[model samples]
Target chain A: MRFSVLILGNSSATPMYERHPTSQVVNHNEQLYLIDCGEGTQMQLTRYGIKSNRINHIFISHLHGDHYLGLVGLISSMHLMGRKTDLHLYGPAPLEEILALNFKYSETELRYNLIFHPTNPTETAVLFESKLLRVESFPLRHRIACTGFRFQEGERPAKLDIDKVAKLQIPPALINGIKWGLDFTDKDGKVHPSSELTTPAPLPRSYAYCSDTVRIPDYLPSIHRANLLYHESTFLHEMKDRAVETFHTTSFEAGEIAKEAEVGHLLLGHYSARYKTKELTLLLDEARSAFPHTDLSVEGKWYEVE
Target chain B: MRFSVLILGNSSATPMYERHPTSQVVNHNEQLYLIDCGEGTQMQLTRYGIKSNRINHIFISHLHGDHYLGLVGLISSMHLMGRKTDLHLYGPAPLEEILALNFKYSETELRYNLIFHPTNPTETAVLFESKLLRVESFPLRHRIACTGFRFQEGERPAKLDIDKVAKLQIPPALINGIKWGLDFTDKDGKVHPSSELTTPAPLPRSYAYCSDTVRIPDYLPSIHRANLLYHESTFLHEMKDRAVETFHTTSFEAGEIAKEAEVGHLLLGHYSARYKTKELTLLLDEARSAFPHTDLSVEGKWYEVE
Candidate 1:
């Protein structure tokens, strides 16, 4: 199974220099899911050669302009381009009214069915589910109602050992049981342990996204053991006071969260516009000091979840 | 006095390679006025090296997202940059509500005074006026309620004839009257003709912007004899039927309007996304076939009204 996250924008509220606001595309086995579409996101997607048509689902974390200002423009462009597939949108309840207002004023009749799945930021619960993956939302500490999403890969069935199954002369009726790790019996009344007939299943991978939030203890468990974790690092240690006042996290605090959660790798982003591009390395280094496996989330960069 | 127009975005609806949606800046005597802010207009202003702080007035033509979607993001950035100047916004009544909704959801209280001036699409009247310039709004045929703007220069002062005034011994109190073309009384108790005391005033220049509209005769008088005219040319001659259906103008129709209004020059823009940059020249040539002084409106180009 292929799972990767492509960073479209990583800057904070204001897009500075070549950096853009918060936006990303999560490619889960070729099914694209968009996370936090900021302004200029459609252009960024075009710059990165990502087709907007592949984005079947969109998840918004909050009502902040930096996170969701680009939604209406992207949706309008999609309708103009003659999109017909039903799009599933998950965000706060106000998002539906916001989108409806735009359409009402523009007199745009959408060519596709837009399905809105309103997400609650006050509680932790599963938001969406499929055969391979399940998405859950948890509360985040911010000035406004906000949410962090966690993608958990579903448990996989054991891989059948084809050669062992043939040699043991397994009946067709027991093939499903063998793949499910159940012991099988042959016509001669011979017992075959599931370990002899099948190989162990691979470890399922998971990813979590937390942004525009302060360091809070409640979010630690939801993002624990994620194969990859993306957390907002809006400031460094020097600006820790400013970060706290803005309901954002410092690089050190982000690293501490990553460490406490024991994630496979940490991706730090949502940098403040006050810092220059060259200064971003300081954030990455500070995060790495606490959690060694940390990297800066750069626009157009892709990180795979192992 | 200085008057110039800077093209920011010229695409009709969809933003394509190297072309953006409808947006332009009118610089009048060092003061910047924004017109029709579409998505990515802020970036376009940055690309053209225009400071956002200098824009104190913004005019949106209609409720179409391609016309005003970039407004909120630009406003937010200005606020973040510590802008305290009052912004005078002139557009349809719905525009104020759209901006208010964005700020409400984002929980952003402005740092500057935002004044809204509502425009009626059914009537032609002056929107704003100063001693040297006046801006008026007129109706345009569109799928929805739309307005076209006309920038009319006020009467110019006559050039002073210092030698004639000295030789005639004209009173200092009559200098203002002399520039305003009033006959002056000489110190010798003789009356000197106004023509001998001062040179005739130069012709006042004017410009008109008609976009997202079909060819209509009602808008002719408001734009008559404009020094420069920018009209929407969303399609080529072959797509006349489609243009009529979509409430857009083809290059030939745009040229015809310019020719009928006796404008000094014609600017054609709002190109369809179907045409590449290489093919834009064909639209210019077709418009020139009807009106010889037609030019294509490319982004970042400045056209002076002389």
Candidate 2:
């Protein structure tokens, strides 16, 4: 099984030559989830060769134009392309109204079902869950109501040992029980230990998307122990006042949050458009000073979650 | 003085490889007027090196997502870039409500003034006029309420013959009178004919943007005798049925409209994404069969009005 995240856009307010606004696609095994689609996301998906049809779940962190302005365009394109799969969208309550109003003006009678799941910006709860994955939302301190999403993969089943099964003469129908660490008794009443038959299952993996938020420690518990954490680093420490005023986080503050949450790796994105591609190293260096496991998020690059 | 139209995006519905959706900038003697901003209009403006601040007026032809979805993003970018000039936007009535909702959600307090002018899709009328140019709107037959725009240059000032002025020893202060086609007189009361001192001004240049429209004859009088006419040619003669069903036009019908309207030159655009850059020549050839002066609109190309 493989789990990864693809960066669709990393720029903050404005989209530049190679840097667009905040958007990314999370690939959990083969299932796809999109987060924070900015303008030009469909183009970015084409640029990266990701099939838009594979994305059934789209999680938007906020209602800022940079974060979700691309929603309508993406949906419109999907509708034009004759997509028939139901789309699940999770965001603020006003987002539903916004989408409805825009659709009314365009007179777009969507061909597929569009399901809206409103997220409370001031509470923590499980937003979505399936057999293989679970998504949780936590409050963030920002100018407007916003939330961060945590993607947690379900615990994988134990791998089967074909050789051991054959040696034990286990029935084919009982393989699932054996894989679940069940002991097998032979016809002659000989007992076999479950631990000796199967190895332990792999622990679940998790990723957190925390962006467009001020440096606040209240949400640390919700994001604790994430395998990979992507936090917004919109400015340097020199612009701390501006960051505080704008309800955005500086690189140092992002690092401190990552360190406090004890995340395995910290990926920094939502860079201000003023920082050129090569110039963003200053932000990385600032974050690394607080947390050594910090890395810059390059657009269109995919990072694996271990 | 220069009057030209820059093709920013030419593809219909879906934005493909090199062609984007409907967007163009009409440059009337350096005053830029934007028509139908698509999803990447801001990026297109940046790519074509047209300063965004230079655009003061924008006209959206319809409420389709591909036509005006980018307006809010463009305006937001302008505000972020510190644009202080008032922006005038003329479009469908719902556009104002949509912008208001989006701005409210984004909490954007624009630093500059934004004025909205609503258009009625059922009538032909002068939508905007200034000292240099006049823009008229005419209804277009489509699935939804739509209209086409005609950009007509104001009556040009008469050009003065510098040699004639110097030979006649006319004062520099009276050159304005000569340029205005007023007869020049000396102290001896001998008058010079306006035609003798000044050449007749070139016929007022005009360009008509008739896109996302079917080949309906109702708009012919509104766009009669334009120097250049851009008509939507979404399909070929083979897909005439599809064109009629979608309320689009075939290339042959586009040519017929051009021929009937007596336009100086016909530029066909808003092509279906199915036509590659090389395949569009078939459309041009087909259009030329009905009107000999038809040309394909190449993206990023600027066509002179005269």
Candidate 3:
């Protein structure tokens, strides 16, 4: 079971100093899920050798150009690459019309079905669910309507104790029930508890993505105690006034949010273009002051959720 | 007197092998004019140290995603960078609505005026004209409505013969008239014709961009005698059938067009992803076989129109 997040782009506002705008990939069980597809995202994916066709679900945090401008190009490329599978997109309600207008002007009839799911920024709700994963979106404070996403792994079945099963000679028919926490009875009518037959399941891992927003308390419960948390830090503590004016968060604010939510690890990203390559460490240092477990998000690097 | 074309991207349909979709910069008198704002164009401009603010005009050939998807992102970046100058955009009639919808959804009231000028692809006509430059658009045969752009230098003023002016002791005020082809009459009643007093102006240079189209004779006259001709060579001659079906040109066909138009030099680009880096030579060799003065368009290289 692999659960990790790969940073594709982390720069905020404009692409400068070889850093692109906000975009990343959440890899769970080898399946790729894209988040916040900023400009040049397709190129970033190509540069990192990520298979874009594998990305079935794409989540846009908002309608800001820095967060979702590359979406049209990426969809067009999927069509050109002969993709026949359905693509699921979740974002603000206006995104559906925006995409439709773009496609209408281009006169493109997509070969694959483009299924759009409009996200609600008014409340926290489940957006997607599969056999192993559950995705949720929650409200975020921003200049426009925006939402944050949380990916949580489904509960795993209890593992069978091979030695105990062999000694007891448990029938194959009862094995399934035993793993599901069902008790078994012997010929003598003595009940054998399922807890003794199997080991407890491992804890499920989760990751939360919050971007293009200022510090807010509305979504804290949704992202609580996530194994990994990626929060937008568009400015340093020195530029708190600018961050407030723009409805963006500072590095220290992101760290404070992670601390308040009690998340396992805080991943800082969406840095402003004003911070040079060497100056990024200052942002990291500022974030670390609030949360000691904070780490800077570097493009193309995978941070596993443990 | 500097007139050149810089290749920012040349890949057709999709971005692959580090080459982005169709985009290039036409520089005349140190003024940058963008042609075909493909995805990642702003990043491309920054990569080559080209000032994005210096580009006041942008011309998109068609509504294809690869041709104009980056337009919104570039425009947004300009706005974010605090641009106050007006931006002139020339493209299909529907493009204005598309941009308006994009800005509306993002709620972005641009800081600068975004002037939109619709182009007609059915007929060849001058799209823009300045004191030193003239840009014209002509129809191209494609699957959709497409146009090609030609950048030509305006007629230059005649150069004054310094030796003749000094020997004749011509007044400084008369020099301007003489340069404008006015005759100078001496007090003794002998007239000095402007042709004899001034040297003839050098030939004005021009560059033509024809892309995402199949071979056609409709616009040959518009690009005739261009100092540099950038023609799309999306496929090799071996894939002529595929080229014809897709309304794209093969290397041989592009070369044929250059030779038929009697252009000074042929710069071939818009290569298909099927051609690997080492295999691009086949396309170049095929085109060279038809036109000896053909050169492959390399990204970041400036081809002078001389």
Candidate 4:
């Protein structure tokens, strides 16, 4: 039941002050999903000890260089490393053309199956679904077509009570079924309810990633009440006009969005190259002015989804 | 009069053991020329305190992802940073199509001009020439179309013998012409030979870059008697057969090439991922066995072309 987000790169537009461009990884029950892979992402993945080959799904928010520049290199590395598992990539439709042209020029036929899924940047839609997780993409207002993602965990099965199971002499094969809410029958033909053998599962957690977007109210409901929300705070309140002009979010605006959506906790990232290390606190302070429970996204750290 | 190379990355195929893919910077008289911009090259430039905007010319060796994947990102950064001067890029013909497609997808009309010059990988030809330097491209034996570059310094003007000129009371305006081997006719009607007022110019220096290639004699004459040579050594002698199959050069083979060309010094790079830090000494040892004036190309270190 491990759910966490790892920040690989957190800077905006360009890499400055030891911070790389925008990229991160989300882990749900050991399955890794990469989000917004910027330049130096592969090196960052190696630096953070994340095995990139384990990543099966990648979601690109936009086609901006800072958001998706490292994609081709990552794909090539995966191919050279002899990956055979099919990789599912979700991004803007033109990204498929970019990848095809790159591979065509390089004369490379990827050893693994690359399945591309075109994400409609104009609407909200469910991008992926599994037994344990569901990922949805929602539109974001930007200079180019962009989208944000919300990863919500589905209802988890009840945990098996090992002590109760041992005392009841439950067979090993039936234990897995019992964890899935199956009723067990005793050897003497006495029926046991599933509720008696298991503990209630925890509430499903959700994490949302919003980047390279202006402050807009249209998609507030899509990320409402998420366990953890990562919002782009490209500038401070002092640069609010610049934020509006560039279709980016100010620190205060990001905080306001988190507060309006009523998220559990707010994670701010995608900082402009203008801010130095000590000045980063000003951004956090400004965001906290609007939303009290807010923290800055630090690269190479794993933030639990809670 | 500085002629040196800074290795940004020195790995082959994939980045491993903290080594990124192949990329380097050649600095001649303060002018920067980028070669083989692999992934993370811009970041590497930043880390090494090299202002990438100063690079006016870029030479890509091949279409391999490790060789040229960072070109688009670097170009985009230059555009965003408000570059106005033209950028000269030399590579295969298809590279133009790649750049056009990338820009079309990003919806970016670059602020600066990107002047493209296609290199012929089959024949030797002078690609660029300035008053001080001449760059020539030659064929390389690789799986794909690849070219090696030779940066040769043009004939330098003679240096003024300042003490002799001062003793003779030469006028300031005439001093410049004396350095270029012009004779001075003194007001006293005395003739001063240009040789008497200036010291002989040193020999012109040249550096050759050969990478991603198998051992072949076709390009040996093009690099003969170079001041310095940077050659790819993707594998050790133990993997000689593997190197041959992959159209790559082993460490011993690279050393042999340097020996046959009679280069001033040999720089061995593009190491395979199989070698660890301690094992890298073995590569150096193997190259040194054939050519004694050989050293491994260390990233971030500047190697002067003497």
lDDT of residue A4 for candidate 1 = 95
Q: Write the per-residue lDDT of candidate 4 for residues A130-210, one digit (tens) a residue.
A: 989999999999999999999999988899888999899999998878878889999899999999999998889999999
Candidate 3 chain B weakest ten by summed lDDT? B13-22
Give per-residue CA lDDT, model 1, range B1-72, as digits (tens). Answer: 789999999988888857888999999889899999998788788788999999998888999888988899
Give one digit per residue, the lDDT tens place, for model 3 in A119-158: 9889998999997999999999899999999999998768
Q: Per-residue CA lDDT of candidate 2, range B1-306, in tens?
A: 798989999889877766787899999988999999988788888888999999999999999888987888899999999999999999989899999999999899999999999988999978899877999988999988999999998888888888988889998888877877888888799999888888888789999999787777889998899999999999999999999999999999999999999999999999997888889999999999999998999889999987
Error of 4 at A264 (Å): 0.9
Which candidate model has the greater lDDT, 3 or 4?
Answer: 4
Q: Indicate the fraction of true inter-chain contacts that candidate 1 also forms.
A: 0.47
By the lDDT metric, which is better: model 1 or model 3? 3
Per-model i-RMS: 1.2, 1.1, 1.1, 1.3
Runs in model 2 deviating more than 4 A are A162-177, A183-194, B168-172, B186-190
Reference-based lDDT, residue A84, model 2: 99
2 or 4, greater by DockQ: 2
DockQ score, prediction 4:
0.71
DockQ, Cα level, model 2 = 0.73
Pairs in clash, predicted candidate 4: none
Off by more than 4 A, model 3: A159-194, B159-198
